[model samples]
Target: MPYDVEKPDEQWRAELSPSEYAVLRQAATEPAFTGEYTDTRTEGVYSCRACGAELFTSGTKFESHCGWPSFYDPKDTDAVELVEDRSHGMVRTEVRCARCGSHLGHVFEGEGYPTPTDQRYCINSISLRLQPTDG
Candidate 1:
């Protein structure tokens, strides 16, 4: 799919670090429980690390104890794109930044989390840039 912030592979590689490119461009998953945002509770907006597009907010973040950071919803309905993922012998919803089409992570549902959407957006920390709000 075409993205609003389309760039050549060479440019993306030059812009993002090795690990960031691996997750954002190559759809690689970071090791669970090792992400920076896994236990972060700061109030802020989490933007896509690759394109600076706001994808989530601290208000929607919740502790699902799922290792990675979890959000009940995106900042806006169109802020992300969910695609059916059938890799690694399983089916799941893969989340990507709508603006840049960079991989954020996967979203899960029906696990009985007491959230308004009943969905868990398990995102990678390296895929996000948290902008903490001033008190």
Candidate 2:
């Protein structure tokens, strides 16, 4: 799919760190419980690290103990784009930033989480840049 912010491969590599590039650009996963936002509770807006597009808000975040920062919903319906992932011998939904198409992570549904949507947007923290709300 086409994205609003399109950068060349070289530019993306230069802009993002090694880990960030691996996840955001190459669709790689970070180690469980190792992300900066994995256990964070600070109120903020989580934006795409690559394009600065607002993806999820702290209000939608929930503790799913899935090793990544999980959100029940995106900040807006158009904030993300979901694609079918059929890797690792399983079918799952992959979430990407709508603005840049950078891979954020995967979203799982029907697992009986207490969230209103029952959907867990298990996102990689390296894929996000949190902007804390003003006190």
Candidate 3:
């Protein structure tokens, strides 16, 4: 369970804002439709807000109407780590930044989404830092 960018809780809290710490460190979900990246369509790469690790690209983003930003895939397979989550009366897959082990969000699959992966990486905007591509 050790991460490449391991830091003490105090350090993490010092670096992240209150909202970012809740979602990224404590795995709390932000209110639906409130995330900054929910409706963003600009070309960019989304990196981990806590660790600066590239996680997803705009090309893989889709409108899932699920209130959060949805990506069909990670920037790379190794960019994220998926773990089985059995909380809140449901079984789901939790996605985290591979480098820092900060929670990104849950990933759901096989719900008939019209995407190559048919999967939705439902991530919180507070968990990401978007770096827009230069045109």
How do the predictions measure up, each by TM-score? 0.98, 0.99, 0.98
Q: Which residue pairs clash within candidate 3? A: none
**Model 3 RMSD, rounded to 1 decimal:** 0.6
- In the range 8-74, model 3's lDDT, one tens digit per residue, is 9999999999999999999999999999999999999999999999999999999999999999999
In angstroms, what RMSD does candidate 1 have relative to the true structure? 0.6
Error of 3 at 48 (Å): 0.1
Clashes of 3: 0
On lDDT, the leading prediction is 1
Q: Per-model C-alpha lDDT, please?
A: 0.98, 0.96, 0.97
lDDT of 2 at 107: 95
Model 3 TM-score relative to the real fold: 0.98
The positional error of residue 135 in candidate 3, measured at the CA in angstroms, is: 1.4
Ranking by lDDT: 1, 3, 2
Preferred candidate (lDDT higher): 1 or 3: 1
Report the CA-based lDDT of candidate 3 relative to the real structure. Answer: 0.97
* Clashes found in each candidate (C-alpha, N, C closer than 3 A): 0, 0, 0
Q: Which ten residues in a row have the lowest lDDT in candidate 1?
A: 1-10
Query: Per-residue lDDT of 96-134 in model 2, one digit per residue for the tens?
Result: 999999999999999999999999999999999999999
